[model samples]
Target: MENVEESLELHDKYQFEVKFTYPLDKTVPYTEYNVETFMFIPNNLCVNHTTYTKDDFYSDMQKYIRLKTPTMLLKNILNDDKSPLKALKEAMKTLVSEPNNELKMLDYKYHLKMFCSIFKSALRDETIFAEKLNDKEDAEDYIKSIIDSTEDIVKKFRDLKDIIHVPGLENKCYALYLFADEFVSLSLDKYRYRMIFNLDKAEVKNKKKIRSELIDLLSAEIEYRKSARYNSCPDEKSDNEELIYRESTLKKLMGSVLFLKTQTMREGIYIEQIVMGLAAGLAMAFATAVAFLSQSKLENFTFSLFMIFVIAYIFKDRMKELTRIFFHRKIQKRLYDRKTNIYNSLNQKIGFCKERFAFFKEKDIPELIKKIRNKDYITELDNGYIGEDIIYSKRFIKILSKKCKNLLDDFNVDGINDIIRFNIRNFLGKMDNPTRPLFMPIEGDIKKIKGGRVYHLNMIIKYGMINKQDIYRKFRIILSRNGIKRIKEIPLTI
Candidate 1:
């Protein structure tokens, strides 16, 4: 399962923690801070906000599988005094519903890091667009959205900055969150019965088993920490924005705008140089005409006309260059202006979004991931997970030449067939280890090498095993991340 920390924008891809922190400030210390944190229940904010635990969902899933209304079944089951599954239900409930100190800390840290992360992402998005734009309307909606989202983002960011600060603290919080999320995933995996079909579960057990164990280790860390500092002392910890990063949003935006202006300035100078060359050529042509008219002699007049022709000929390319430069610059600026307008609007939107972070509704960003469980119980209702298994399919789309077909064709002319008959298994044995390629025993695509072709069949290692005797083995292996499948061989070049 992917780490739950990635759900928040503050973390990197599959990362849970921030590299730096703001010193955590509280009335006493960590204990007095409000502990309730965000929960991950995709697309269903109501569920995320509620007190419902994973065990409750498990019971609901069982109802879903039985084709009964979950609400109705839950009501009836809760009232029942003697159900065989009741004890198991109660045990799973504690895993989710019980107060876990480590989990609480994770929730708190994520909430804080997410505020800063979202803010930076929005700002960066707007700034990148601003450079591409030259007109107003293209970025109209995008800018509006940024502005609409910014204020609420910034307000909450301030709230987070006030308390959560420590260089390495966010990393721990993210780690804790991952462990907690993974534990919950494992609980759901049990209901899915992923291990039942895997005969190799002993060697490659379900990933959830390891995730559960990790959560145990993380929980132990918090449970055994030196609580004496927070519980016994009344010292106040002060946090400030300076603890995290130095640059402000406005400063970053200014830097981007400056860079765009610099490019425009260089383009303008190049156009100016083209214009100067054209002007110099025209001036020389005019001077030659004047000199011809003043001399009046037929010979001198003819000479002056020839000189004018030479000047024009010499500047022919210059004239063309000037026209091209002027036309291109005009068209480019026109296009750039349209995009610039959009980016400016987007920039404004981001600024507005940043300023008002506190008042926005929670879950403003709609859920992108919709699977609620391993089996996605909402859509797959009444269909219990049966799991999948490794199966093979084969294909042979390519054929090798007669010379390449015989593994011993080039090497052992006298005993080529005998060599295959005696040590064919040994050649096949070499193919078993994926680190080395299966030697093609023929030349191919010689341009890649310095001289003679030393070709090796390009087979993917993780796909499956290959054998040197192509006449005996005509198919190749196809595999997914789970296990190998067989595929028919495509034609191979000699």
Candidate 2:
């Protein structure tokens, strides 16, 4: 199952998280390698008229987008039947009982890493879900559940630490304890802010209570962090540096324990390079032939012969460039822009993700895409008057389902999360002011009114899987000179 959530991030950036879940139960027997996504930009806001180019778009994407290593979903980690935390606790018990067993010790470390990474992520997911709850009762329940779960987990960690007298592992145990404490504080802090900004006035009392509880949790976390065992600032750095140091240390620990690893490389780069080399050779052959023919005909060092040679050189250069461009375009048509390989913690390859980007004219767009765009329109006159430019992006993902399911013997692992954040700063350069003054007649006298000037950039994505019906989603991104104004989902009825 594939799910996507989209929202605006910062002021000029749009973020979307795509969750690819591989279910353990018998169902569709196909891979998700045929997904295609498209974005339609107004001509005035595109490279055709503005200064933004394909290179700029790609650069911005690289800066903003993030592809996190695939891990188990929060629900899966928190599942009562098969919890990583529970498994971790059991592993710890065994390690403490038989510390000399190297294989058992390694198993304990693996479980510890899996629990820490998944626990942190699951808390984040749960907190976000809690904040989005509309029912006050549900919100209260979720908040309480989070607090109870964290407190119980922390207590268990403390108990385990008390028993862990094994030398050379104090730092690891203390780090896990601190990680749980700090993450709860951070997640609750975020929840408190969400309640203040997102919840309604009717829940003022409940919100206040939640806020108070969150503050208490944060205070406890702070006190725990300041305890003697876990130093707040060992290096005696400034406050900001101390916070950075703690976060950096925690991240390093997490990296060490993470199960999945990823490596990205430019797709088809070698073959494309070879194709370009062949193109250059072809162009050079033509140029050499021209030079030979010119030399033979002239047979003298005269002005005419010099002119002929110069013309041949110019044509040769032009021919090489033209041929190179032609071959590049052909390569683009056949290959993706980038490829990412996914590997297990054991350094074995499991799956790969491939993505491509391109520009398309209206005439070149698919009929279904055009239909989705023109839905409910009174006429085609708008398109005729102001033709839009289309930007196409595609993803081909392939995962070994059995490998992911068997990642952890305790529970089935969830698939990858492709988090893409796109910045629209490039599209804002050519936009007019956010508001333009308009003169209007008011009671026989002319009055000025400030009218909003905005542009709409539509994006339509097609999600495809073998033997499964494709799903389509369209979004209208309202923009101004300042940045993105808002994004509205256009429902598909056809």
Q: Number of the top candidate by lDDT?
A: 2
Error of 1 at 336 (Å): 12
RMSD of each: 32.3, 5.9
Residue-by-residue lDDT tens digits, candidate 2, 1-494:
35433333333344333333332222333245456767777666645523656566667664212223335545455456667767877887787777778887778776766666666666667767776677878877777777777667656545665545466554665455556545434444445455445444435337777767767766666676667344442243455666667666765566465435788888998988898888889878987897788788888888987887788788888888888899888878999888888777667776777878777778888999888987335223434566777778787877665555445555444434454567777777777788989999999999999899887777787775555667687787787887777778888757
How high is the lDDT of residue 62 in model 2?
A: 40
Over 1-494, each residue of candidate 1 has an lDDT whose tens digit, in order, gives 11001011112211121111111111221111001111211221122213333233222211000000011121222233422123223322332343355655533433322222223333444534533454445433433343333333323322332232234344554343333322222222221232222212323233355335434533433342223121211113734343122223322322231111101112234545666666556655655665565456545546666775666556654656666566655644322110111012113210000000011122332232111112235323322232211111121111111222222121111110000000111112212232333333345532332222111111211111122211211223232222232333434232
> How does each model score on TM-score?
0.16, 0.73
State the displacement of the C-alpha of residue 267, model 2, in Å, after optimal TM-score superposition.
2.9
| Clashes in predicted model 1 | 46
For model 1 the local lDDT of residue 20 reads 10
Worst 10 residues of 1 by lDDT: 350-359
Pairs that collide in candidate 2 are: none
